[model samples]
Target: MTTEKLVSEIRKKHSFLCVGLDVDLDKIPSFLLNEEDPIFSFNKAIIDATHQFAVAYKPNTAFYEAYGIQGWKSLEKTIKYLNENYPEVFTIADAKRGDIGNTSSRYAKAFFEDLGFDSVTVAPYMGKDSVEPFLNFKDKHTILLALTSNEGAFDFQTKKVEDDEVYKHVLKTSKNWKNSENLMYVIGATKAEYLAEVRNIVPKSFLLVPGVGAQGGSLTEVCKYGMAENIGLLINSSRGIIYASQEANFAEVAAKQAEKMQLEMKTILDGIH
Candidate 1:
């Protein structure tokens, strides 16, 4: 999907919510375990239930990788289902894959062409050579890790290299990359305070924000600082929404959780208008 189409979905749905499909079999309802492909079955239910309230869905690669080949198949099925049924909803492969130039090209193909994801989370630590390959695919986005929500982010991301923080340099330097317009960023909701500085670097770039709900990051604070004119934030909630219940009504409960966030997002969007 194009960036404009993504924004259109947000406007149509009154949401910028990205439901994280970081499904763990152990955490899912016991009943689903009996299904032939439990991971895909669980994902289908959640997608059906929550698609209306979400503009995007992100499946972290680790969850599926844990189950080996079967897990990879489930991930494939999940994306295929979304592509055929809910094409309007943006799909993200939350696979933080990055390496040397040639290797990164294959990674891009795996997610963008083979798996059919609209975007993929990429680690920019390897520099432009590693990231430019992903940007070569038109309409596909490479969401670079900027400032993350994890506590460990303090170790290197925030350190001052010269006069500015390391992440600031990332934002500034990445803007000049080939096809930089296709670049989005991952800024954790917990680091809302640094948003103004980030915006100054790339005023209209979209942000894939994790660390809401379960991580105790305030939605209000994130929007207060991070929101752009085009509503460039995809706030993710995984455990808090998808695992709201492990009973038969799990999908319905997940929808309710999504609705709660969408309603809050509606209020924020209304305020913006």
Candidate 2:
């Protein structure tokens, strides 16, 4: 989906929420295991229940990859279901893949052409050559890791490189890459304070922010500094929403959790206008 269309969906739904389909079999209700494909079954239920309240759905690749071939099948089914049923909802493959130019191109093709994801998460440690391949795919976004929502982020992201923080350098330098307009970024909600400085570097790029509910990040603080005129933030909630309840009524409970965030987002959008 185009950035404009994504923004349009955010406005139409009064939400920038991106539900994370980071399904772990151990965490999901055991009843789903009886189904032919437990992972896909669980994802379908959650997507159906929460799609209305969310503008995007991100399925972290690790969850599926851990299960091997069956996991890959489940992931394929999940994305196919979304594309067929809810084409308006943006899909992100949280793969965090980066490699040599030739290798990165294959990875890009796997997610963008074969898997049909609207965007894919990528690591930037390998520099422009590794990421430029992914950016070349028209209409597909390459969301580079900038400031993450993990305890280890301080190990390098916040460390000063000359005068500016390392992540700030990543944000500034990425703009010069090929097809950079298609680039988005991952900025953890936990580091909301750094958002103002982040925005000053790339005022228009979209940010896929994780670490909200489960991680105790402040949604209000994130928006206060990170929100752009277009509301360029896709706040994700995984465990907090999908695992709201592991009972038979899991989908219903997930919907309720999503609705709560959607309502808050609507209020924020209202104030923006």
Off by over 4 Å in 1: none
**Model 2 misplacement above 4 A:** none
User: lDDT per model, in order?
Assistant: 0.94, 0.96
TM-scores of the candidates are: 0.99, 0.99
- Mark the 10 consecutive residues where model 2 has the least summed lDDT: 189-198
Expressed as tens digits, the lDDT of each residue in 1-273 for candidate 2 is: 899999999999999999999999999999999999999999999999999999999999999999999999999999999999999999999999999999999999999999999999999999999999999988999999999999999999999998888999999899999899999999999978899999999998999999998898999999999999989999999998999999999999999999999999999989989
Spell out the clash pairs found in candidate 1.
none
Query: Cα RMSDs of all predictions?
Result: 0.6, 0.5
